[model samples]
Target chain A: MDDYRELKPEDLVEDPAFRAWVYHGTGAEAWNEWVNEHPDHAQAADLARNILASVRGELDSFPGSEVKNRVQRILESLDAGRSGTHPADRSANHRDRRLWWQAAAAGLVLAAGLGALIYTRLPEAPAEKKSVAFVRAPGTSDQTHLEIVNDSESPRLVNLPDGSSVLLKRASGIRFPRQFAVAKREVELSGEAFFEVKKNPEHPFFVYAGQMVTRVIGTSFTIRSYQSDATAKIRVKTGKVSVWAAETVLTASQEPSTGIQELVLEPNQQAEFSRSDLKFALLENDRPEVAPIPIEQMSFEFRRTAVSDVFEAIRTAYQVDIRYDAGLLRRCSVTASLGDEPLTEKLNMICEVIGATYREKNGKIYIEAGGCE
Target chain B: MRPKLILQEDPVSPLWQLLCSGDKDAFGQITENCYKPLYHYGTKFTDDRELIKDCLQDLFLDIWEKRAHLSGVANPRPYLFQAFRNNLLRRTRRVSRFSEIGAEDELEFSSFSYEAEWIHRETEAGLEQKLQLVMKQLPKRQREALYLRYYENLTYEEIADVMGLRRQAVANYLQYGIQKLRDYWQQVVISLVLLLAS
Candidate 1:
């Protein structure tokens, strides 16, 4: 602290950027170091304090709605640029799925050899069974027709057949086969819907949303053909989906650039077709989408998956949160294959079984694990 | 004045996850949500709406592109404000761009009636006015860094991602920026204090 006392007034006058420099450049450690060393530099510290106060005042004045709206707009523009109409990599989706299945089978066989007892215990409590649950809101009945009509609300979700689900954002309704179409699975949706399709190579799932039709062999995808919005969009998560608007198909297409476009999506590559512009744009590809590969075959793993990361993944995948003390996240690790589990079930299983504390806060489930007890 | 509706909290927020996944939604959400603040931040530097919009758009896009590789983020809001600042710096760096604009030229812009709606008493209003004057002298990048870091409260990593620099570089920029501000403002404060005493 004495170091700052000896500093000349000129030293403070000459440097204005030190506040942010010490705070960000050297982390809390260096910032504290500077404050301790220069305790008597009251003028310097006061200036920094004033500037921070003003900035905080401004930010505090900023409305949260502005933040949400800004984020939405940026997403929309980027979505416009990197839509589905970009060039299609027809074979990439198929190639990856085949590779995953093969790897999973091989890993399982190897694991069985090493631990016979573990292999024998596997079927006792089925992982997939636990993952699957009836995620019904205060409903009419389990057998009654489940309809989520988002007339007043933004969007609602519904589970479709073949172990997949659909989130119908506001003003959307989807009807699926009671038990899934035997040969060709189909769903009729009027509005925006995100689909996580179950892989059934023998039975292709088809979505008849609007003037557009999306067909998938087996993949995870999100479709936003919201009835109100002019544009219809689709982003593939895993496997491949073939999408065709009114007149075009990616395969054996007739009219080139001018006509309505078609696209086949690879994992992480999105395909969006807007009816207004009647064109498409493909976004730059991201790293890769992680789907349900065999647990034994897991290679890309987070050493100790940060609780924050887990919370984010769950929220994104299911649009829910297991809220907890933000500070407690530093000590938590969640190791699990993020398969096709609904958001609530995953959180419930993770928090409840672990003896962690969790409850709904403003419609979000917050969980506290390590330090809670 | 800012819209009252802007303060309401969204319940089922998925945008944070989208940011983590480097999804395009994250970018879109920022553009939609932060347009007003970014626009205003730009206006603080230059009243040119088109320029502000352009800078913000590019900044948001770049943030989206680099999201996957972005590390050490506890939040995204501050990161975005930082991005807005960096974009302003890159654009303003072309000396000719600044030389062309005149202070007298009035640009028709959207009134932040939302801000005006909040009636401030005399002393608070005076402080705000003084603060604005202090902010005006800050170098473009430093102003941005300070705004995003302290105002929006972004982490160093987020600032680095937005500014296209390493963590240390962001620290240097911010530190240097803050140091300058402190010295510059001290004279203003001293004069005011002495005048009051006299």
Candidate 2:
């Protein structure tokens, strides 16, 4: 520490260490010890101390509530700029991610490959979300519905109280009770989400997305019901899924009107509902062309392999089931190297060789043939 | 008197994850939670509420647009502060708007004012007044560095980040700023004492 014995009041404040001592209440040991050890410099040290003390004071800042209101407006506008839907290509990419949403939700841990697309499914209605009410007494509510939204580019992992997990997509949201009720594990969703639900026969898992409600005993599936989307969809990756249009609730007094439809979906099946018509259809999922299959599993090189064996290999590679009787195909064999061909083309060639016909039913491919007599 | 509730600064919180993950509500909470501190910092530049608001709005929109690319950070408060400062400076530079009102630098940060709820002693009120005047006369960058250090309670490194200066530069600013305040206070006191004696 420099001797303050000769240093003036102005010179004292110029030292970074002295200023640190004054403001931060630190770096004063050497200076104070030096002053105490030498009484002659006490007067000058005292004068320097007085100058530093008088210069410090409190500064008033803007009111919190006013700035908070202004900032809220800014954030809302930011949300609208990016998530109020996007250009056609971007929307399609987000829309297509719906398939992966199911597979990923099924606890498969699939790759969220198309993460760059700005996926937005705005609710048609300007929701008077009770965000403020929730904030006002966050501590008071014992079972308040906890809402979570993945507004990021990639999927976010959400652990549910019931031991299930959700892989929420970007610009998507889910609201669930803080604790799953004993009766049911109910959660509401907006936009797109994939769920990997815990199996509890005593309590069924339910997801309410827009005008559609999906119930599962225990399984993984994806739901797409962006408020602004013209069509709402539900795709099952595994296990049985039961879905019903929420029109029944909207058209009160009409018990199960013809307008209300319920559909059951199995693995590799998708249910699409049009908002304008209030009607839904079950369709076989289009083959996941973009699904990342392992390089080694990409080729179908079967040499004198049983027809059943061929189907088994396809199932392992594509995660799609091909239903066929092993008994009828006991004598059937095939020798062909199918490389990079479309799934349908490969299936066609195999079915022709085995003298069997194939048809898609509920996302499953079924094969039938008169026993090889 | 400053309201404690309004002046509350957020600790490093989960708000960062929520914001980076594209949660609109998280964005809303952040605005409501950190706006006062941010506004307090912005007004140090200029008191025009509208301009500050506009700049803040633009900053937030930019954050949301690039949410996908943003790193999942734990504490983004400093980053927000830096962004607000940069935006305000950039906008003010374009028109030299606030400076036209006073002879202060175009990007002048508002120095400590005496009318504020000062915590100085009754005996040192006059000294405080003189100190305030000295503060106003300090260079803009020095004033900013002092504000970030003593006022915001930011570390030397954090102040450097906000001011876009090296840590050494920030240390020098504080040193020079305090020195100037002490010198001016002495001069004003000596002149006052002499006038009284006459």
Candidate 3:
């Protein structure tokens, strides 16, 4: 309005409330008035609001207990301000250095002896520890490496490129490429990652795990597809995503021979699939039917499963291999959460219940029967 | 000097002095004074509570840590609010939580702005609750614009800068909010009149 043009800066100075409203609302109508009357006051008012906001926000959202604890530990370490083993004023003279070498030599000898004794006395079995091998794409950097530490101890934050963040769950490992390609962004995930994807409409992000793939333009979601589980699942926390199984079987008579079947998912929906049988099952807000039957079935009952699967979860979950002394393969059933139990403990527990002993050698666990009938 | 003297100095002068001196107490007092209006600004802009909290918290922490190096904080409130506003925009660049809600996702200001002496004196008892009820009845854009312009004293250009809209758009939203609030109050007054007449 012309009247707004005519308004003087004095008008705003006389009315602080009006000024507050104008500034608060981001209205420029009062700008002319504010500048005309009290140009300095306009800027002054702006600074006051900003400073107040910063301080209030800090006091309001002070770090949570965990973050505070971590910061406190770091600060406490700073107070000591040294490799605490050495005194601050100590000089590394030749004599002192010699004494250190002597002490180190004596300690090494004692430690070697103790280690030898402990090694011989502690173990009854020579078991092969299975290690996970990550097959990364070419040109992947060592800095992009992800590790899942499971000691029932603490949680960790993982840093990622593209400003997209992921909080890795405990005991979960994920491997992603260091530099994301413009055409596609993909990560091989085992365990779980809560992903906050940067929205780029041109380049949609894809998460690959076994036969299932999760495609998203921009969204927040969680995926848990450990090799230990029969079915991999993708859960969306916020935003939309397209989930699909890449390896589905089709007859020759079918027009399209490709094995891809796309399933659109909204928030809170999960897409689950069994890679062996090429069957897909979707679950929402609840656990899907992962396995066909109950765990207590007689004879080895596998529904939509493969016998020659290398990372057979049943073998790990029950802790007993199918081979009975490397001759007869006992068909033992398996179904349960393996999260709480160790691989060795689970096998031992199941073996004892089924009247069998597990023998381990060179890393492979074998089931031996005592002839229960 | 006494705390009273500290308060008596021109607000801008004291704030500038305090910031230069790296006085944490002064920083905290400034924040305590400004938080409500800033919060109102944040809530009005984005309905995502978590995002607002994150942006606001990050903005303040940034200011406190960087206070020693900062220059030209003549009015700390605008700078702080502006910073918060910028943080929100940057954080929401990838895809905002509020984007999906479209126009319907207006910030519902439920909290009480109890610090305003004039509002309290006029409303008497349960003013905060009444304000909240009245706020709930406001149109999404109107409430948002009102909280930012009236509560924060931001220029229309500044609001446009924060909201990533044209200056004219901010002006329109501000006028709309004020008109709606006035209309709502007039309706209340009219209903009371009608009840008395009956």
Candidate 4:
């Protein structure tokens, strides 16, 4: 008990009896008495208790029947092994067979890569020719379309004709018209891409990815729709977007649509469209076990934050390089909520507040300012 | 000075001894008691249920074969965990080498929503989400150390033995992990205050 007199919260968290008391009410009276005696340590003790309880709350366990079944299988195998059958020899054999098959598959993949490399060495063909080929819709064949495919290792920025922009991930492709239609703007996407749609209330933006269509007036969101994946997902970053199944949209095109199962997603909400059942499931960002929301969706809210720190936050969240003199901006501070505006608008607002000017060159933002007043 | 509570000795020690002395029923009892916790812990490593099941079977079978040599083991739970973790990692590495799977040895906690009633009202709204984010971003070794300390309830020395680190290193990992959570909590409180003020 005396040893606990000078213990920090961390030390108390590691104490077994203290943990037992917090977890199961074991020796609660003694711990309560100790806390009463040492008023100064009570806060530390309470903090430690909270930490331990929260951690314990995160634990997950399997069902008792499942445990029993697994144990039964193991004991049965042991019983068989005791009766002159060698489980060790059998498992070793199984491992050898698996290793052999894996080695064969690796060799085949290596051969294919070597063949592709040899073919690429010839100068007649363009490098992007071997990448994804864009397929034009039958009815829209007369309309000129532009396609951008990102086959490189880094994200590629595509500036749409309407001032909207997309940061396309590796192995992704986006196809849009040369000029927007008078009624709306539309794009076709494959794989994953983060989109920042330009605000046009009269002409809503539509994204057709896999078996789903996402309609947004002016917002940023991410859509992941791989050809090989079982489900396509759209996560809203800012504002609201309505998602509908492609079949529903097609049917609505023929007639007035009513009672349509359209899912409206807000910031931090996501909708997953399963290809098998053609159903949409809504999810919140609170579930950490699910695939994380892209960094672009991270919200930014600064309350009297340093101007330099604000730029740093944007730089990291957008994965873009920003050149600025941190020492000059150290004295400049701003209080504003961000994350709903586009990258340029965010920069514009921040620079306006700090009396700074910024220029974009070669995909980087450079800020110039004489020290703040 | 306050009185110290009398802690009970490890209850699994006698069962472990009996298993070592060629008692099959004792081995069964150990398996039944340990399989669920071990399975839950294995989930922190990988999501492949088949792979985890295979490794667990291999672990228990190996233990039965080498019971004579394991009699000197004082703590059975941590000892089993160490062995099982090593086996799972070795198998995953072997599989990933040929398959090109991401075999980074990181622990992933199972996702479960915090019960709102259980959380303190002041910090209840978004604390769980922030905690999850912080937990995800923690270094792999620190997360494992914290898991062993809080989830498995292992002492620093036992955790050190399991992780093959010095006892002080385990202590440092727990301190750093807990401090990160505390810092995030403070930030959340401050942000809430600012939100209310505005």
Instruction: Provide DockQ values for all models, in the order shown.
Output: 0.11, 0.08, 0.02, 0.14
lDDT of 1 by residue, B127-190 (tens): 6476455545554555556565664445678777765678897787777766665554454444
Please give fnat for model 3.
Answer: 0.02
**Candidate 3 lDDT:** 0.45
Instruction: Give the winner by lDDT.
Output: 4
lDDT of 4 by residue, B1-198 (tens): 533547776566779999998888898889988886677677667656666777888898899999999999989988998999899888777877776565663333432213211122234457656655675676777767777888677889988988899998998888888898666544533443343334
lDDT of 3 by residue, B111-191 (tens): 322112112232335544675466555555454445556544567876666566798988777655545444433333333
Q: What would the per-residue lDDT of candidate 3 be over residues A1-373, giving only the tens digit for each residue?
A: 3333433333332244433332222222344344346533433333233222211111121112323342333333334543441223323231111111111112222222222222233344133311121211111234433333321223333444555655555445555556665565656554555666777788777765544667888776677665445566776656788876532111001111134566777766777766444355777545323331111111233342322231255443232344543223334433332222224444565565545677766446666665433
Go through the candidates in order and give each one's C-alpha lDDT: 0.48, 0.57, 0.45, 0.65
**Candidate 2 ranges with C-alpha deviation above 4 Å:** A1-61, A82-373, B1-10, B72-75, B97-104, B115-137, B183-198
Score residue A118 of candidate 3 by CA lDDT: 27
Comparing 1 and 2 by lDDT, which wins? 2
CAPRI verdict (incorrect, acceptable, medium, high) for model 2? incorrect
Ranking by TM-score: 4, 2, 1, 3
Q: Provide the lowest-lDDT 10-residue window in model 4 chain A.
A: A96-105
lDDT of 3 at B45: 52
In model 2, the number of clashes is 5
TM-score of 1: 0.29
lDDT of 2 by residue, B57-132 (tens): 6777787777777766545877888988888878777647544664245466653433121212211467657555
Residue A282 miss distance in model 1 (angstroms): 4.4
State how far residue A40 of model 3 sits from its true place (Å).
Answer: 38
Report how far off residue A6 is in candidate 2 (Å): 17
Interface RMSD of predicted model 3: 26.4
